[model samples]
Target: MSQKNNKKRPKSRSWRGLFRRRSDPHRAYREKYLETLQYQHRTFDVKGLTTQGIFTLELARVFVDLGLGQMGQRPSTDPIPRFAPAQQRERHSIWEYLTSESLQNHNLAVLGAPGSGKTTLLKHLTLTLASPESLPESVQGMPRMPILLLLRDYAAIIEEEPDFSLLTAVKQELARREENIPLDWLAQDLQNGRCLIMLDGLDEVAKPQLRRQVVAWVERQMQLYRNNRFIITSRPFGYRNNPLNGVLVLEVRPFTPEQVRQFIHNWYLANEIKSAGHDDKGVRLDARQGAEDLLVRLRQTPVLLDMSVNPLLLTMIATVHRYRSSLPGRRVELYEEICEVFLGKRHEARGILYDLTPAQKKRVLQPLAYAMMLHKQREISIEEAMAIIDEPLSRVSPHTPRNEFLRMIENTSGLLVEREVGMLGFAHLTFQEYLTAVHVLDQRLEHELVQHI
Candidate 1:
């Protein structure tokens, strides 16, 4: 009986072992319920089946397994090009200016007409300043790495605020690069002399109020970073208030005849070489010769030298010169045609002064007539013109804002350039002749009418 009892006890123990703990139906059900809740939470109904829900479940599982959800992501934009001073020397003289001892105290103002390589020069300068090798020996004592903030990009980032703090904007920009290398640490390494902030395109920023604010901010930044240099480029008139009034202003003169000739020759040679490498050898050689001859002809004009050698301009020049047989005459005709095209068909006899609104027409005629007379006599500045017209600029075409008026003139066949502040001048003497011809044509028309009557 004892042996049977022992055997039963052992059998009972073994059975308990086999069963382990009772599978709690409640707990199991609870777990399943929670899992169903999770599935529901993660899932979405797609036409009766939760495909998106399933995808979410899978993704969640993957994310959970990888432990990767904590890190944030941002939409990517084009990376800023690292500065390379040596390579950009072809485009910007600012590199030379900055490196030179003479320009140390000089605050530069690079002025150029639109598409006159101002942006390219500024971009090159930005890149150069950003490069490691270009860092001045003195900057090694400073604490932060120099930051280049495209004011436009900065404005976009801080859209809520109408008034932006340049210092704060700069700090935020530097913080963004923290992942790369700590700017504070970099600045510490340079002993606070590390950063050279470059603000580009003061003229392109659309709002006048913002421009004024930015200019003030820039002035503050200049004051804050006395060791650092600020370089700016803009079209004339935009800086009428002369934000950097006391700072040394160095203008970017148009490319010299030699510079232009070299650019054209080099461009032609590059094309010739590129064409020759292609399968059509005869065509390439002929093109090369033709380009060389064209380059010779283009070098004769100072204006043509500065202007980009685009196909459209080239074709227009070719057509005009081919018909006229004289470069000067061709240039004059081209300018006139451009004015006519922009001002309308009647511009040659009637003048653009006629196209202005009644009030504007009245305000402009006397000033324009005086400008024409001065232009006929010799080159004159807008300031000089204002003096000749004997009226405040506000009184002259009050309806048309200054920049728009200048743009109107600029777009009118590209002959007139806003040369400097309060200066409107022809791109070349030939263009001046064209304007004079418009005046002459008007006078002749009047004379003929009087005689006919």
Candidate 2:
């Protein structure tokens, strides 16, 4: 009887082992999904331009120290000791400080103006956490998965489901990314403090009501997912009310002269490698000359320096300077030149010709710009954008098909971008503002204001 029982036990165990060996479709899908995500989001898509650069966040972040108090001031609870060690007084990257803390109770709000490298910093952080090899010494060996959620996308989700939550939104995002991760697995990871949530672009929420909801949702997420780390980003004005509680607010500092110089050097060095041929020496020489010229301009002109301190503008300056061999003297002139470059000259220089002239394109875009400004919108639907082009298209070129014209504008014009499917926004907020300013001036609003004053 004992021998028979033992034999039955072995058979049952073998059957169970065989069942386990069978392939799990869900598990297989998850493994492939992770690989795909690692391939897709492992690097920053610099400037959202076809001419992209691969830069680590460590290189992009300016090391500015902050005291943990109100609006970057000294902490209320403590005073600095006069004889404190030099190391304690030294500056550190916000990234370093953030990792050093007990994140279970900590949340961070990173505020910066448009084109101020906020997104870039977030991207760097995501990539670093996502890719273990890129992790800093302090965060190394930590078991965590970084999930990056564009708040604009999250706001849209909340609109669809009034009862939506941060975790649900994250699950939706993972699904969109084609990741087949199970909710149980995600919940386990979150509960174990193995997740870093990076919520980017709170400012991109176009509506105030929607933005406020997003803020509330974020604050709730911090409480609910108390074990995990969280970082939220926004433009300064967008976060004026200080919505998130128990949060450290850190502002991204403008690039200093030395940092700017280093950036230029790195930019040229990276680009020169791509442009190099058999004569590498000539490419290097030209790159050095370009960097030197840009540095000289930044040093000599305060206005130019002011513009160059922001990474987006500086990158554009570098891009324009690389191709054009000169920068416009005035700020408006620079924008105008940039507009023209995007409209026609950039394509022409690349030996591609679009049918629309720069003037015709400008006429078509001006009314759209004006509408966006009047409505206080940063993004527009494709249908609305086409309607905007229709009025100008009729006046400038009556024969132009609206669809064809819109396609051409999107393809050749660097000024406009398709932020998501069926949606569009200016390449940068600054471009939108510049175009809106031009529209206002053209309408004689400046003269009317002066008269009223």
For each candidate in the order shown, give its overall lDDT on alpha carbons.
0.42, 0.61
For residues 1-453, could you state the per-residue lDDT of candidate 1 as single tens digits?
001111110001121221233563333332332233233223211121111111211112111000001001211010111223432243434545454444444445554433344444443333333333444563332222334456655544344564566555645654554422222333332233434455666654445676676676667667655555566665444454445753544444334334434444434444444445543667556655655566666766655543433222332344344334456434655654434433333232222223353333223333454355454533456555545434433665555554555444543324445535456655445445455445546555445324533
The window of 10 residues in a row where model 2 has the poorest summed lDDT is: 1-10
Best by lDDT: 2
lDDT of 2 at 445: 72
Off by over 4 Å in 2: 1-38, 42-91, 102-104, 141-143, 165-167, 178-184, 277-286, 328-333, 337-453
List runs of model 1 lying over 4 Å from the truth.
Answer: 1-93, 101-107, 113-116, 127-191, 205-209, 270-291, 299-398, 401-429, 432-453
Question: Tens digits of per-residue lDDT for model 2 on 407-428?
Answer: 5565445366665677777765
